[model samples]
Target: KGKAFFVDLTLCTACRGCQVACKQWKDLPAEETRNVGSHQNPQDLSAKTIRLVRFNEVKEDGKLKWLFFPEQCRHCIEPPCKYIGNMYADGAVKQDPVTGAVIMTDKTKGITRLESWEMCPYNVPRRDEESGIWNKCDMCINRISKGMLPACVKSCPTGTMNFGDRDEMLALANARLAEVQKTNPDAYLADPEHVRVIYLCESAPENYHDRLVASAAQRKNLVAAAPKPKTVTRR
Candidate 1:
C-alpha cells in the first residue's frame, strides 16, 4: 500500500517548523536571504529548499487575511514529469511504486531541465546549478521505508501535516474537510483524486497558489509555450 499526506491548510500557522526540519533531515545547505517584506523567506522553492511555506496577504470581507501554504510536490498518482523526462532520458524522473513518491534521480543530469518544469503542474522541480541534476521532495522515502513518518510531518507543531497509508490519509482528509466546512462552507480538498498529497483548503484553492489545483488549461499553456529542450550529449 502506497503512503500519502493529508495537509490541513487551516491548521498551518506558518511557523515553518516543517520547513526547517526538512532541511535538517536532508542536510541541505542554508540559503542566504534578506527580509523580503514578508515573513516568508527565500521566496520560493529551490534545489536546496524543497519544502516552502508560501505566504499571501489577501483582503476578505474587508478584513486582512494571511494565507500560508506549505507547498511541496503533490506526487501525482500518474506523474507527467516522469513521462516528459523519459522522453529525453530514461529513469531521470520516476514514481516509486511502494510509496507513490515522485523522485528526480541523478539520471536527471542527462535530461533537459526545462522539460521537467514544463510538465510538472505544481511547478515543484528545481535544478541544481552545481550538479546539473533536478530535485524535489521524495516523501522522505528513507525514513518512511523504515516505518517512520516523513520529517516534515513529524516536526509540524500543529496538526497540519498527517501521513499514513493512502486510504487512511484520504479518509482523514475527507473527515477534516467536513469539520472545516461547518465553519467555512467553502472549504474543500485540493485535487485529492489526482495527488498523493492532499490539501484541505479553507477557501478557493487558488487563494493559496494559482497552481494549487492543476488545471487542463495550465498544463496546455505550459506545454505549448515551453521552449525546445536543449540536446543533451550524454557523457
Candidate 2:
C-alpha cells in the first residue's frame, strides 16, 4: 500500500549525488563547512540538508574499510513524532496515507522544537531557525504526486538507491542481502519490515551509523514509557 526505498549500502560510493540533488530540489542553501579529513562533508544533517551520505571508516581484520550510508528519514510504520506533534498541533507531522511518507508540515511551526527531537527515536528532524518549522526528507512528495521518483533516488549514479512499492522493495532488499552475504556474511537489512527506507548494510548495522536505525536503548526507553507520547513544552 505504500512506497519504499531499498538502499544497498555496499554499492554506495559516498559520491553524495543524492545529497546534492536533495538540496537542489528543495532549494535549501548550503551550510558553511570545512574539510573534516573524511570525504563526508557538512558532518551531519540540518534543516537545509535533509539527505546525508554518512561515512564511517573502521578497521576490520587489520584493514580499514569505509562504510557509506546515504541517510534519510525512515518513515516509520508507527511514527512517534507524528503522535507527539498531534498532541500540540494536529497535522503538524503526519504519515501520508498513500505513500507512507512521514512528513513535517507547516503546522510544525507551532510545536516545541526540542520535543519534536526527543520524540523522534532516529533523531532525523531539524528545526529551521528562521521559519521555526522542522525539516527532513519528505520522500519528494511534490515529485511523487506527479508520478516520479524521489530526487535523491533519481540522481544516484550507482544502483544503491531503489524505489517502488513496499512489497517490491522488500523482495529486492532480501535478495540483495542474500547476494551480499556470500561475500560478507555479516551483511543485514536494517529495519526492513518496520520502515519504508530500508538499508542493506555490509556489516553490523552500528558499524554503518549510530542512528542507522532506532537504537535498542531507545526502544527500551520507549517501552518503559509504555509507549506514551509525552508532551514537551518549550524550555
Candidate 3:
C-alpha cells in the first residue's frame, strides 16, 4: 500500500507536540531564534529543522482567527525534485518503493546545488551552508520500515496527525472535510490527489501559504513549464 499522512488542521491546537517530536527523533540541534513577534519560532524550515508549525492570523467576519499549518515535505507521488536530480545523477534522490517516501541521499552532494534544490515546487529542500548537502523529510523511513508511525504522528496528542494506507487516509480526509463544512463552508483538502500529505484546511489555502494548494490547472501549468531534458542540463 502507498504511504499517507492526514493532517487535520482544525483539530490541531498549535501545541507544537509534533514540532518538538520531529526535532527530538531526528536529534537535530536547536536554532537560536529571536522573538519574531509571532508564536511561530525559527520562522522557517532549515537543514536542522525538518518540520515547523506555521501560525497565521486571518480576519473572519471582522474577528481575528488563528490558523495553524504544521508544515513539512509533501512527498509527492512523482516528485519533481527526484526527477530533476535523477536526470543528472543516478542516486542523488531516491523514492522508497515500499512506502513512497522521497529521500535525499549523500549522492545528492554530487549534483549541482542550484538544480537539485530549486526543482522542488514546495521549496521543501534545504542545503547545508557549509557542506552544501540537501536535506528534507524522509517520512521517517527507518522507523516506518520497522512498522512504526512517523515521530510527528506518534507525538501528536490531539490526533491532528495520522498515518496509514493511501486509500484510508483519503477517506478519512473527506469525512473530516464534511464535518468541518458544517460550520466552515470554505473548508477543503489542499492538493488531495497529488500529494501524500493531505491537509484539511478551514479557510482559503492562500491564507496559510501560497503553495498550500496547487489547483489542477496550476499543476498542469507547472508540468508544462518544466524544462525538457534536451533544453536543460541536469548538472
Off by over 4 Å in 2: 113-117, 215-234
The stretch of ten residues in a row with the least summed lDDT in candidate 2 is: 226-235
As for candidate 2, its clashing pairs are none
Instruction: Summarize candidate 1's per-residue lDDT along 67-108 as a digit string, tens digits.
Output: 999999998887777777666668888878889988889998
TM-score of 3: 0.91
How many clashing residue pairs, candidate 3?
0
Tens-place lDDT digits, model 2, residues 20-85:
999999999999999978777888888988999888888889999998988898988777777766
Candidate 1: how many backbone clashes? 0
Score residue 65 of candidate 2 by CA lDDT. Answer: 91
Instruction: Sort the candidates on lDDT, descending order.
Output: 1, 3, 2
| lDDT computed for candidate 1 | 0.86
Better of 1 and 3 by lDDT: 1
**For candidate 2, what is the TM-score?**
0.92
Local accuracy of candidate 3 as per-residue lDDT tens digits, 110-222: 55636323467777788777787778889999999999999999999999999999999999999999999999888889888889999999888788877786555654555
Off by over 4 Å in 1: 113-116, 216-235
lDDT of all predictions: 0.86, 0.83, 0.84
